[model samples]
Target: MSTLPVLNNADMYHHYSDVQFRDGCSVIHEMLKPKRGESILDLGCGTGRLTMQLASLVGDSGRVVGVDPDSCRIAVANEQLKKMDDIPVTFQLGSIREALPLGPFDGIFSNYVFHWFERAERAEMMHQMYDSLKPGGRLTFVLETNQPQPNAIIRDIFRLTEPNLDEESASGMKMDVPSVWLQHCSDAGFLVELSEVFRTEKAGPNLDAILQFLKASIPNFQPIKLTDDGLHELDSRYKTGNGDEVAFSLTVLKVLARKPQES
Candidate 1:
């Protein structure tokens, strides 16, 4: 699909991501390597599942804040935090479209959030992230990229149904090339020490599960408006390559950029 993946709305996403997002991002903890007493930011922290994990890792002396544009997501995250007796994390209903926390943080992390913006906005987001970090602070994230297999079966279904879905309309969802981000990091004064793409495949009981995951986790991944039957038909069409099982793969690009300590 040309559009970035996203849940139809925050609430629908809240329902699915509350359980799945944490498990899906299990790899990020090791990637983040959050240290005790360090200040970290979870950009686009959905429902605080990983936020709580980050909070625990930071220990009593550490600090972390989760930011998202959706108020409902922030609210849900806040509610989840309340269940805990103590946490070092906070949630804000904000976005990278605007400013971020004023900090020179030890690290900043985003899971599936960067692709939501266009290239220019992404550059702005990068500068803000670079400015928010400490001299040697790091920024790392996992986002979908159009590479090796920009397999967007969802968009194909949309095209088959709406023959007139032009490129302008389809372009709303992005499968950005990796070089775009690498350049953004450079423009934002970050030294990109690591960059790589990891391919993940998913096949499950049915298309419904995968559909919900895509709609929930991806940002603007699907176009608005479609009947239930239409979605089911789309799902069936996707399985043509895999028989009864629904199989698909997504390319996740992991980037680690560090602000120069001297600068």
Candidate 2:
């Protein structure tokens, strides 16, 4: 996985992600409906926290394969997996954009990881996922929708600092709308089981907390290098100030689709 991209702050990513991924795990379990002895894939499994939970759900007879592009994250995940010798789970260090060999899987579940790719990479990713699944397998994932989504403080700051560039030309990965993602799944021969976009509110106590969270997120998704000046500028405009706290709301997109049985 030498060619795969990784965040410099892998430790920060692991610490910050434990909470965000925990909530997504419940949703994944509800939608994926994992059963014992089923072979499942956890796409972009990060430090393998959610993957372990999935392993527990599937039990001893089952197998869970967790894949992530970041070698740093995979190393940590392997370290953690070493202690859980009883579970039938393995961590693989590779990008989902790359070809995978261990499936014909019963199901595939990913949370908050698909928006990083550009159009062509995403096309390949969807195709690879379709190829990896069994005849009647399912895939469920949660990611932000394109446009009108929240957590744009950095984007806004970049605009203010360098006003010439447009949003499309901005240096970040693009997120697609729900319809586009559904269409991609359909094109890849998957049936749309559940598809919806909804809103959620998330907040931080102050500017420092918010910046810390963004620092953890931005590096993993895009190669943007945020500076102290950029942070100050973003905080000046984006954070809502009250007596002693600040907050914001974010729009989220969720989809759960499945591959139909081949006849």
- For every candidate, C-alpha RMSD to the true structure in Å: 4.3, 3.6
Q: Flag regions of model 1 displaced more than 4 Å.
A: 1-8, 18-27, 97-101, 148-151, 160-162, 166-171, 213-245
Clashing pairs in 2: none
Candidate-wise lDDT, in order = 0.69, 0.72
- Please report, as a residue range, the 10-residue window in candidate 2 with the lowest summed lDDT: 1-10
TM-score top scorer? 2
Give residue 34's lDDT in candidate 1 (0 to 100): 83
**Candidate with best lDDT:** 2
Candidate 1 backbone clash number = 14
Give the Cα error of residue 91 in candidate 2, in Å.
0.7
Could you tell me the C-alpha RMSD of candidate 1 in Å? 4.3
> In candidate 1, where is summed lDDT lowest over 10 consecutive residues?
1-10
